[model samples]
Each structure stands twice: as C-alpha cells, then as structure tokens.
Target: MAARTRAIVPDRSAGIKPLNYNFEVKPPAFITFEGLDGCGKTTQIERLAGYLRSRGEPVMVTREPGGTGIGERIREVVLGQQPAPAAELALMCASRAQSVEEIIRPGLAAGAWVLCDRFHDATEAYQGGGRGFDREAIAALHRVLCGDLQPNLTLILDLDPRLALARARRLPAASRFEAESEVFFARVAAVYREIAAREPWRCRLIPAEGTIDEVAGRVREAVDDVD
Candidate 1:
C-alpha cells in the first residue's frame, strides 16, 4: 500500500505483461488485495469486485503470475512442479510488469477501481521472505522498475500458517506458489505481518480463517475505508 502520485499519458494504456521498465501510465490509482495462495484472495476479489460494481463504482478484477496473453504463457512455464525458484520469481515478475502496465495502470487511470489479487508485495513476501531472498533486493526491484506505483489500499488476509496450507491443499492447484509446504507458507504469513506492521496506515489485516461470507465481510470493511 505504498501510495504515491505520478502523472501519465492519457491514452497510452498497454496490455498486461511488460518485461522492460518502460511504462507510461494512463489509469487512475488502484486498490490491491494480496495474501498467501489460499487465504481467499480470489474469492475476496470476486466479492469486492461485485460489491463495488453494485455501487456503480468502476472495478477491474485481475491477478498476477498470469493476467495477459503473454502472461498466461509465462504462467504455465513458471508453475511447473520443478521450476527453479529464481526462474519462477523472475517469470512472475515478468508477468506482473506487463499486468501493471496493461491492466492495472490503465484501468486505474481510466477511473476504474482496480482490484488485484496479488501485486509486487507477493514478490517480497514469497520470493524474498518465504523463499529466503533479500528483502532489500525485492524492495529495490519495485522501487526501481515500478517507481512509485504502489497500491492505494492493500488488504492483507492473514490466517494461521498451518491452517492456510491445509485449506490450500484442499483446493485445486493454482500456481507454483500454491505448492509450497506449510512451513513455507507460515514464513509468508510472518512476512505479511511484518509488512502490515511497517505500513499500518495502508494495510488492514483480516482473520481469513473462517467461512467465506465471514471473511468477505472483513474484506469489505477494509476496502470501504477512505485513504
């Protein structure tokens, strides 16, 4: 939820999946929702998107590791059972760069309330923290390549590490990130907490270890706030 303001070209919105750092914005700022693989991010995104749409607010629902045409291809490559961690993270970042440019930035610019399932913070938490990469390195990539285009609002759904992994196992395998072990996801939750602690004003943590509607209620309240 590193909110910042920057001007952009009015009609240069591209599609999702930019590998290079060359981005010219065309959308308004956005709200992003992020968490571990099965902490109800997708369900919450759908509910939030529906809620905002009902209010006549423009909303865009999207996800990372695969958002655009090219990104979906990368998604397949990155999700293999034995993909290298660096390779996986690199591909994920590649997908995100384009998603930010094409779907996120442009949608935000067009006054649509962009609601993403995951963002760069996923990179920091999973790739850096859970996977044992350097936090400074992850931050450096976002700070440099992404500039100041952080989420206007971020809802980090936190659940007990073991419980999250257990639930995740019950669901269909979504991506490479979803295949990590319980201890790995536990580490991710810890990192997410650290993130919220560091950015209290920007993040609202919800106990995502409950019924769908119950968790969704928390998600709505968090997004209903004014930044």
Candidate 2:
C-alpha cells in the first residue's frame, strides 16, 4: 500500500490579514493610552479595542517598547535594567522607531484602528518629567524618529501616583519604573496632565478611579466623536 499523504491548512482566523498596499480607505485612527504604571492603561486599551471591534471596525492593538520583535528586546532592557536617563530615552526612541516602521504605520496604512498602549508621550512623562530630561530634546528626537506620526487620540488615564504605584506593586513582577519612589510617579503624572493641557485637541484626560466598566465608559466617550 502507498503511504498516505496529508495537506496542511493555514489558520486564516488568527492574526491580521496581509496588507493592502494600495489601500484607498480614509486613514484609520491611531489611538494611544497614556498613564502611570498601573493606571488601567492595559485594561482600558483592550476594552476600547473590543468595543471598536464590536462595531465592525478593523482594530489592531499594539504597545510601545514591545510592539515588534526588536522593540520587545529593548523593552526587557529598559524595564528590567533601569538604564541611565539618556540611555533609557534612546532605547525607548529606538523601540518606537522600529514599531512605527514595522507595526504601526503598516497597520494604519491597511486601514485598521491601531490602539497603542503607550507612545512617545510616555517618554515625555517618564524621561522628561520623571528623569529630568529636557522636553525639547525629547520632542526633537521624536520628530526625527517618528517623523510627524502622532496619535489621533491620546486617552490619558489620570490617577494618583500613590494609588497607581500601589496597584502596580501588587503585580507579580515589578518593573524598574514601578520601583521608583512616589515622587517620580508624581512628576510623571504631572507631565501627563501637561501634555493633555498643551494638546487639548489631541489628548483627553480621563479620570481613572472607578470600576472597569465605568472607566471604560469614559474611555468610550472620549473617542466617540473622534471620527
């Protein structure tokens, strides 16, 4: 008897479909979630993604500092090793550059709602405010690396640093940033607020103290009119 032959079927249900280089749809929205370590960014981002998908929208969820293969490796270094301020900023920008070219730009080009957990604003908060780096320098770097790519909507989950830090510490593994003192987080939070104020057209400051559903409701409202 002849040996039996089998054919493998590809799993088309998972992962995004191949990019349509000639995609002609109106540009998709690129939204980013910004906040302190445990201010519910991860939770709200997923909730927003689900809500968008339920509306028959094409959504792609990604995170900064770990969105791509290269970014993930750099994320490990920046989160675990606690490099110097300048080095940390550099690593973050490097990751952002890779993510923009590898994941974000392509996803947007393909007409998908790109939901990012964090973006360049995180660097402005963490490095500029928390680490005392110059905001102008960070902005210059962002212009070079990201090149005018800005989120259509930045939902900043505002919460007390003390509470956010406590929530963060409850997680199984604490990151280098999580271990910083409350003062550091306060500075970060302040910077986030500043970003919201300075860029009211692009950033929305959402109060982050509530049940998941309640916070998610606010998140939804923030983007309801975002087109």
Candidate 3:
C-alpha cells in the first residue's frame, strides 16, 4: 500500500509531489479524520500532523467542537450530557459552523494543511444514526450553518464496538457520546460502517484494532495517497 501511495500530487500550481514528496504551495490541503470512541482518531490526527510538519509542510492540527474560542464553550455544553439530544446536536452543528468559518476555511486559504480530528461524521454517527434523530432535519441545519463543506478526505477508524467501549471506559473523563451504552455503541459503529460503505470516494475505513503507531501508519497513507 505504501508503494501504491506514491501517486497523489495536487499539480503544478499546488506543488504537491508524490509521497515523501516535499513541495511548497500557496494553500495546503484539507483532510479530516473521524472514528468511533476509542478508535484512535486523535492519536492518528496528531501523528499525521507531526509527520507533515517534519516533512516541512505547514500543517494545522485542529478539531471540531473546540477548534475556536466560541467553539470550546459550545463543546462543553453539547458534549456534557446536560443538553437534550436535539439541543446538543444543534450546538454541535453551530460549533462546527463556527469552526469551519473561523478556523478551517482561513487555514486552508493560508496554505496550511489542516488535519481535523472529528468533523461532520460525528453528528451523523451520534445524533442522526445513533440517537435516531431526523436525518433531514440535521442535514438542513448543517446546510444552513456550514454550506456543504465536507472534508476532502475522511479516514474512519473502524473497530469492534466492544473493544472500543472497553477502551473508552478506561479513560478518566469521557464525553456524553463515549458514556453511551454498549448497545448504543453497537448502533453507532453500524452507522459509521454504513457511512463508509455509502461514501467510498470520501470515506476510507482503516482497521482500528491495532496499536497507536500501527493506526497512524494507516492514516499517513490516507493523507499522503490523496486519492
């Protein structure tokens, strides 16, 4: 796969060469990473950003919910378990809108490769797919807030629900989604898989059953491969 990953340059204007390819550009690429709880999304995002920086590509390590100043406040409310599901999803959508407007769009415009930990996929998995909310409703709100700025490439860390739940429980503090029941996690995992199947062009499923470094290697391919 690494050998095959040698083909994804952005072009003459973008100045992106092949993998291990180092070139400068006026504006960098935008990629987002997503996965269920304990699927190592954060770890992989951090590793990818670090690797890009090591290669001398300007990289921005950002996250949804709390990427910007206003977003951090909304993150506390939406993921804190107090808000109703509908209300929480609203907050999340608003926060994501703000993030895209304030952090992501500008960073992409500035030629800094933006690596996001979680993007719109969380809403799909959690609120729409997990909580049984109206997909049309969420989609409409998202449209109004974000205007269809989906991630260019989304790498979903697919893992067994049981394993992910167990790992999540070991964490000292977790968000509302992480504290969901095992059955709920099973449902969410199903949704994540469904999305991956439905959107093969934008979504790539990487087995999340390995060590952190192993998972990061997969993420590196997703970003560097570009296709």
TM-scores for the candidates: 0.84, 0.87, 0.85
The best candidate by lDDT is 2
Which pairs of residues collide in candidate 3?
A: 27-111, 28-111
The lDDT values for all models are: 0.73, 0.83, 0.74
Model 3, CA-based lDDT: 0.74
What is the TM-score (0 to 1) of candidate 3?
0.85
Clashes of 3: 2
lDDT of 3 by residue, 1-227 (tens): 12122234333331211122222222366677877788888888888778888988788877878889998998887767589877888888888888888988898888788888888777878887789987556656777787756666678899999899888778777777777888898878887887777555567899988788888888777666653
Query: What does the lDDT read for residue 133 in candidate 1?
Result: 80
What does the lDDT read for residue 211 in candidate 2?
A: 98
- TM-score of candidate 2 on Cα atoms, chains taken together: 0.87
